[model samples]
Target: MRSITSRRNVIMKAIVVFIITGLLTIPGYTLAGTSNISSNGTPHHPAFVESRDDLVNVQVAHRSSPSHPMAPNTADVNIIELLQQLNEPLILGYLENLTSFGPRETGTPSCDQAAHYIFDTFQNMGLVVRYHNYTDATVSGSNVEATLYGNDTTNIFIICGHYDSVAAGPGADDDGSGVAAVLAAAEIMRNYDFDHTVRFVAFSGEEQGLIGSYHYVQDAYNSNESIVAVLNADMIGFTATGSDGIVGKIFENPASEWIVSFTQDISVIYSDYIGIQLFPQGETWGSDHYYFWEYGYDAVFYHEYHFNDYYHSANDTIDRMNITYSTRFSRLILATLAQMAQQPVQQRPVLEISSISGGLGVTAQINNIGDANASDVKATILITGGLFNLINVQSTSEQTVLNAQGSMQSKAMVFRLGKILITVAADASNADQVTKQATGFLLGPFVLEVVIAP
Candidate 1:
């Protein structure tokens, strides 16, 4: 393993002299490869084997890679490392403190202690924190909020989890995992600078039908807060099932497809899970994210995607959690926040021509209205009734370049997402045409027609 100092040096070099063009021109690639294509007939480059299947394809019923060589360049995020170090222990300690308070049921004494603990932690992080207080029947609780102002309030990114634990279960996997993830993310994010404001929130009364979250959402609406996305981490700590009856699952709310997709993209490089699982059923109304989604804000929930058999049981203790998994999961959240905090709000492509056909080769163009550029242009040409579906990519085409100037075009294909829709995005750093160039550019959507006869 390389020393931290060595890693820092490489990272500095990559930052100082990283040529975007050269990085895109590696030879015999397996990861994300960039290329320049020529329409004029020429010898074709060999396609490298895919390292993973496209998750978007699995979710949206479509999906779509490459390599280039350059002088050895490396980078390590010291901030990420430092943040991880600072937040990991803080999270463990927070969990310990919560355990001390006992099971935090809605309107219970333990719940109040947990709430105050979260609020104080936010204040300690040097954030401008507040509470969205409300009541349900006899119970009154608040959604703790911590804000770090950025360039604009209209561009807001929220990271949240529920702090309240269940009564009979102790609620370790149910939410203690999520609360830990949120606290850790907050501690790390507090030290960073972003172009958009970031909100770190912990809601109480989630297990009791999202009362706390509902109150917070109403508060946001009343205050006219411009929330772009809500990243709800609920039950992220439970990573394993022991022989004594433990169920561990990871959940990413389906409503948060965009957020999930972006997170998964980064996870491909930084985390253990390569198969980015999207579309895991509808919102269960189990966590805080549902409140945000219900109120018209884009929201996604994150958790292990299985059942914790010890759920709602006293055995749902912290010892059963995969600490190593939790630690890595925290890092994944860190990387995602770092990347997203720097990005403009995400925007899906406006489908111009849903389907196009010509038995002969046809072209498609999709527009991206978001400030960020779209890359990893995957055009899946499927033969509806035939036994063939052609996959074409402009990100690796030597002749096709989809820059901020215009939509990327494929070398007119005969069989496309036949009578079907296609999706495009920045799948890799090499294919990110909008990196710095897309900082302020609002490119158009991908408009393409498919071939029905051919």
Candidate 2:
């Protein structure tokens, strides 16, 4: 008994609903307000629009983002001296040998030859060497892993670089520098013992969209491995004209920022030995680190700040590369890995507030009484119990490191006029915290009298 007009309205509403539902289900169809737009005002298609596999890969890449530990403020003497063993000539020799295999394109005989050379070198270093074989629809190759197993086998750290080149060139600068660095690191680090296992890996098929790395990471994930951190080096030997040979760039994603910060600390602590400075940059997807990020592991990519014009071409050879730069970069990475993999039975640092005084400000002397070095030490000064209990101020000192039996002074300027209870405390990573207290009369940037609390 419905009216003709009402019937017509109902049909029209159903039509509209059906049209919208159909549009929502279509691939590449985005709502008007929700469409992703590029910086140039063009409508950017979502990854799924081109291929559903791309969307799946992106989702997998964001599966897990782990945080890394804070960096230390000081370097170990043993590590510093060990770094002296890495020289320009040593790295150049490795690079020359790698490139001698010719262009190591994946699935080619040259690539197989290069893999064999790396495996043999690792075996010669007396490390636990193995070939991680992987086969996909496009490429099949073996990833070489040389492991220095730590006392704690559950925790693992990896330093890696690709060894494959494009079809056109030997790929010396593109990755030979990185491979050379890894081999040099393995040669030196094999003699030391660490708390966590360290892996030196050379992957192939990197030029073909990270095939080897992707396969390796996927398997590691499937086996439920606990990988602490990954440091990846690619194309780290080029120094352009007018560019400072000492400065290198480290690229990292948000999850791997701690690793970048840690590398920065290593650069500062070993600046004299490495002779290389580091600057942190945002994430890049062109290296093996991309696969680690995709599987939720924290990783950082080390590369030259100056791009190589000869990348992926026949011109990427030894003469065009800087061996000194490569050696320095390799030294920095080696120092970082050595620290992250703590030495077995190493003594922990002990921090103590040796003395507290007030003059132009409140000053506290912090000392490392333990046999080990104290890093990222911080001293804090607190003032309270002034006139009418109106004073409650606090100040902290800049973070620093104290070698065994070494001491540093931390001061906080005060501008109050009254009697105050002063509490001074100092702490550091891997060290015991210490505190001291005293009653002082402050007179405009100076303490007239202080009574030490027993």
Candidate 3:
């Protein structure tokens, strides 16, 4: 548990972001999967949580964490080399070109030109690319997708951002930022080796209720595709204070909770570059991630931490955003995709915590159950329970290493309160860069708070 003052401070920051941001939803196509339904039988996307409003729950999710929630180790994994290939000048050029095309409104000629630019860019990267063109009575839009295949084609990992905007603005911040990330990631990641497929997509008609994503998901369902996850970025360049700070939210649904957790862990590993702050927003109404979540797929939504005041307006232009921030976010995107594509550890290290007797010192055991060496193994503990659950419970971390089939142990003295909860988490990585985490909770009889009637 955290202090009320600290929690309230974060929530105050979150209220401002939702007020002026365009979100992206995830998975759904013409597939046979069932959409989530509420008790009233109305179609509902299981909203996850709120931005900073749900930070407490987010902390709880990380409380019983996995060793390697993300397949590969949390190390840099050649991602920095790939990120180095990210040409900021090129990204600026792309944003400039995209913004100059004016508002790429759904079904407009301007939008089509932007589509051609992306399509051509992907071709130059030598990726397997194509166009997802959609038509309605009013307007037609094209969604550009580029593919970099890995050893496992069945497990498709997608990263995308909407390209279209409202008819009023240039949309440099609303979406051009995200599109810029996609463009940059594509150019750099094309040279990498991945174990799973990567699809870099630029969606159109997003301002008109995620039309392009909906259309693509429909076809994807009809084609019977294996979509492991959809990582969507929208409005990621807008930093209210305009510094190098990379403030953003990691949004996902209940089924996709792992995505959020994994992302938070990944961000910690790359905190120097991404600096991403997690706000587990369960119910996000707008953007591409919504559609993916609707269709029963694991998806994640990335957006700026602070909302842009000129959102969805003509004033939305490249000059208003911090391009350096976008560069860092794009770098994190490729790194995450590459990490997920890495091969899994056949022999994973398992960490366990046991022997809880309040003040009785707790023990954490690490077993390198995998066939490789586990390096930089760390175990952490946190205990909170006192008068009003506020006191110096216990917080400590220990580190070590374990070879194949080897085991180790660490113990920390814990204070026993009338009723307290203990959180034990361990993280370790194999020599091959495959990582894993183990977490457990020892709960004492403690009721948090009263539930109010809705």
Candidate 4:
């Protein structure tokens, strides 16, 4: 009986060792079939993380680009012309409107007067204006909203600034700057007929924690309003002036990269001649834009990087303001709005396989459904798991074919066709890019098979 028991124990030990060996070999077996295989033919752990700081959770929606190919009407909206228009009368007029009382805090009589001034300005421009008013005790204020309808009323872009000045400070740079920019943009685009709608808002109670913006966003959401992006122009009046004073600042948000890119493109085109410096700040807390961003709305904060010292004190008056900076900033905002208003919709890519018989050469086509063209678009193939290693695919305006190296960033390759995967990956952008991956494999080899055999 003792001998039999010893033999059983040895067999059990062998079984456990075999189980451990199989478990250890499982990942290798699985990756061998997929594109996760290394150049040495060994399976590699696919680098797929749940979250990445730079990764954008982009939705392939049929939306239009904010860039319209149309030309601008006014050729001479230069610094001289812009500054001439934003003269002392206009600057002081706006400041007076802002500082009619000490601390035009929300819900105060001063707040109401500020709203009236903004509303009157919009009305005087001969454009339709609407106000979305709500009472909030936090800032103890009321909100003002104005909308200029376009050819397409279904889609709208929003521009907002806080009008209610702070209590201890005049809040000129804090928001009076933003309010002025909003008015300037409104006046410029008043007579223009756009393809998309625009809403110019002067928010109150921002010092009290974005109360007005919260109310506005809540109302829009409740009404099922379709707003694509919210461009918050706050505190752009004062900038670092000198020889290199042309700096364009935008606060960064992971969910709003597209908006930031769009603004950057416009700033590059419109302000580069002035030596424009485009800055993307990742951390900015105070402003009305935060409320819209909180609601998952694509929001971008436009400002000048180094604001002047006269921000929020008794000295935060209009005389110290930089009308040149304000004019340039306003013009940029107007240009962006005008361009986006007439943009064609963007299309998602559609992949179609044409011929796969050329051994390593796979040819296909990519169709763009959106009106906007993906000029630099490329393609890459990843083997689910097989002997065929996906190198790189290049896209042309007409076709996308697999290349030996698989460089996805090849500008020569336009992705009018579907991507072809072969021995190499087409570009570095897709080299580490993952389409799908498993977290952990505990059981056996994960095999991804690429069947080239007909």
- Tens digit per residue, CA lDDT, model 1, 1-454: 9999999999988874554323223221122344443221111110111212310111111111011111111223643464346444666776777667778887888888888988898899899988778876746887788998887666677888777776875667567777787788787777768777888888887666666787787667666676766777766665444321222223334334556666665665543332233333444445566556555566766666444567666888888776555565656666666566666443333212223323234333443333334455443222111112223223222223234334443323222222232222222232322110000100112223332221
Candidates in order, TM-scores: namely 0.57, 0.65, 0.61, 0.60
- How far off is residue 53 in model 1, in Å? 37
Candidate 2, residue 207: how far the Cα is off, in Å: 0.5
TM-score, cand. 1: 0.57
* Candidate 3: tens digits of C-alpha lDDT, residues 173-229: 778988888888888878878887889999987766566787787677656676877
Which runs in model 2 stand beyond 4 Å of their true positions? 1-67, 343-454
Candidate models: Cα lDDT each: 0.54, 0.78, 0.65, 0.55
Q: How many clashing pairs in candidate 3?
A: 35
Tens-place lDDT digits, model 4, residues 253-294: 655666677666766665633335567776354566765655
**TM-score: model 4 vs. ground truth:** 0.60
Regarding lDDT, does 1 or 3 come out ahead? 3
Candidate 4 regions exceeding 4 Å error are 1-88, 134-137, 221-224, 254-277, 343-454
For residue 176, model 4's alpha carbon misses the true position, in angstroms, by 0.5
